[model samples]
Target: MGARLLFVAALTLGVSGLAAAGAAATGAERCAVDDLERRVCLEAPARRLVALSPGATELAFAAGAGERVVAVVAHSDYPARARKLPSVGDYNRIDLEALVGLRPDLVIGWVTGNPEEQLETLESLGTQVFYIEPRTVEGVAGTLKRIGRLAGSEATAEQEAEAFLDGMEKLEARYAERDPVRTFYQVWDAPLMTLNGEHLIGRAIEACGGANVFGDQPRLVPRLDDEAVLEANPEVIITGSDEESMDNDWLGHWRQYPNMAAVAEDNLYTVPADPLVRPTPRFLQGAQSLCERIDQARPGSGAE
Candidate 1:
């Protein structure tokens, strides 16, 4: 009797220890992470998720956790798969009741990138809201790894990281020493909204072997006057989607500028804001497409 009791007690202790270890691992990595941004990413694994940021949505799908996602924010149309997901809200807005109805285990959003009011409503429901603050391509690797760990797929995440690094290496070699194209990226037309170097979209311009004409501007969105654009004199003008929320009609407006060098040479390009704007693994895919496009435009540049 004594021997049997001892064996049972030992087994119980072992089970308890294993359970504790699991609990420790499942606890979001944020509270423990020193960096605020990395910490937020650590809080994923997010079954029944509501993705508020386009980047986070891309990351979730890339991590192979798409089945766990319940809904995605508007305009997450990349991967062709994202479009099939249900809607939670737009980038800066949310339908709080709809999000609550989903009973999401996690809600991923952008820190300071989203409007405060929308964030608060989600938080009030006791849902874990993860904020990602990826600023560069390098930063994206960290986000991918952390998200993978949270989702219990570290191996997949590492593979993605390796693949991205390899692709970028080839891109760099292909464009190394080639003449840098001065490019103008227009986000909007009425105000002539353009991107600054600080944002991921602008950095993507550099990634594609081009220099942002507004590289010096600090704000993500800078309103440039017509004279400023003329002064910038971009060799290639890359505009995407429609400014008026209409199907990409840049071609219509672009035709009016027959005198512009980009128009004359047919350098006007349109990239969808959905996948192109998001900062996930697919983002590299989009940037790679951009590089291919730029290489095609320049012609003598080596194509990887």
Candidate 2:
């Protein structure tokens, strides 16, 4: 806890200092570097913005650019207001005519989620696209700042980013040094999928002082069979439910394997899928819940 506190303190101070310096240097035009390392510059704050992915929509709103978002893709349903926005299409397919009709001054996109050809077309049509892909916990915070910079909402964005960092620090302080437990996080059950170390959920497992049994898998999301899971025999098994109201049937399926360590100990758990899966501010809430669950499964925690 002490070491993590020190690290978080250093990180928060460094980011806050840099953000202030960067804000002071801004001129008439606002510019932000995207995930691709491409600089996107706007002559003024964008009044009409289109978000092509759900996560991007959430991020734009988090940056206090909600009113500026004129359109969003399907499933960009967060902040309650996003669902009411005009939809050009889903992440896979976009209606070019509808998108153009909206006269969006800026388009927020996902580097890996959105279709590449469509994004290129939008850029070719003179639309400014800011691509975001947050691969790490800190990267998520940085994305808010960049999004705010592009939208001319730096002040609000800075506050949200700092809040997220502080929440993460609290979770880290509470769980980072706890006794390590072997964990298996199931992403899906049809073919039995799990995340690799590079994925956010895998990092969440590590953050809670739990080791992802399949963290070394080469693929970001790997498919496995029951036999493979039995071999790994993780001490804890966790999965996410699509909504808070839904039951986690996937976790219950493993009960058939009575000899499996997690099944034997009944350490299976579920978290809200959207918060945990989405790389947005709500992720902090999800991570905290996960850490508490893992702590309860620890040797001296008095679990069944």
Candidate 3:
């Protein structure tokens, strides 16, 4: 009887030791509010992470968690190292089993691009999910800081966030009050889509002393017919292309409409698609390029 009692006591001690070890491993609690307005908390810095979107992968790297990332989705090629990581799937479709197999401690998801069901599944499986969606320049900066806090990379994240804010401030000071050039920013070629003022790109245009012709459109991104383009008669037209060196075919198509002000002035321009389209720190690169293009389109700035 005494031997059995001693065995039970040893078993109890073992369980207590395990509990203590778990508590020690958890460290301190950290929390961040995501774009979904949900508060996500972690007992310790994420040791293994998975990013669900290309943009989120870049943001996680910026947060100094790049080394901690164990999985990513397609097109997350930024920072060079991210490309070497395993891919669970793309933004639209996720491979649930593959992602779960990675045993990620945290998952970063895009509010707009990622499927809600997949995110829900991840959460249901006891994985922490943080949704990020930055719609404005300021929002992007804030996201970096928040992500950094969650990942325990606060110092690096803060420095990057400050640099981004400073860069944006300089751009705003340089171009905010310049002559307003009537501009049309084409987002897609096949259907001819443009962003309204509510969109970040539209705000970028405004900051560069250019007016988006479709700024008043209700839709964030609206499809416009050629007739609308002819009617607006924008002073300059800008579009993002996949290749930095290649001019988009849409620009050539506009050349046929010689009467169009942008066509007549030779103001159709193509900027690098990566920085301009993605809501990452590289947006400043695209913003600078855009400002230069708009300045070139100005009267006497030089045409063709």
What would the TM-scores of all predictions be?
Answer: 0.77, 0.88, 0.90
Residue pairs with clashing backbones, model 2 = none
TM-score of 1: 0.77
Every candidate's lDDT: 0.69, 0.84, 0.85
Q: Residue-wise lDDT of candidate 1 within 56-172, one digit each (tens)?
A: 788877766677788888877655788998897787877666666666656777776678776765555455576777778777876777666666667888888778767766766
Clashes of each: 0, 0, 0
Q: Of the pair 2 and 3, which is ahead by TM-score?
A: 3
lDDT of 2 by residue, 108-225 (tens): 8889888999888767656678988897889999999998998889999999999999988878787867899889989889989999989987888898898899999999999999
Model 1 residue pairs with clashes: none
Candidate 1: Cα lDDT at 237: 77
Q: Pick the candidate with the highest TM-score.
A: 3
Model 1 clash tally, residue pairs: 0
- Angstrom error of the Cα, residue 6, model 2: value is 56
* Candidate 2 to truth, TM: 0.88
Model 1 ranges off by over 4 Å: 1-45, 78-81, 242-248, 251-260, 299-304
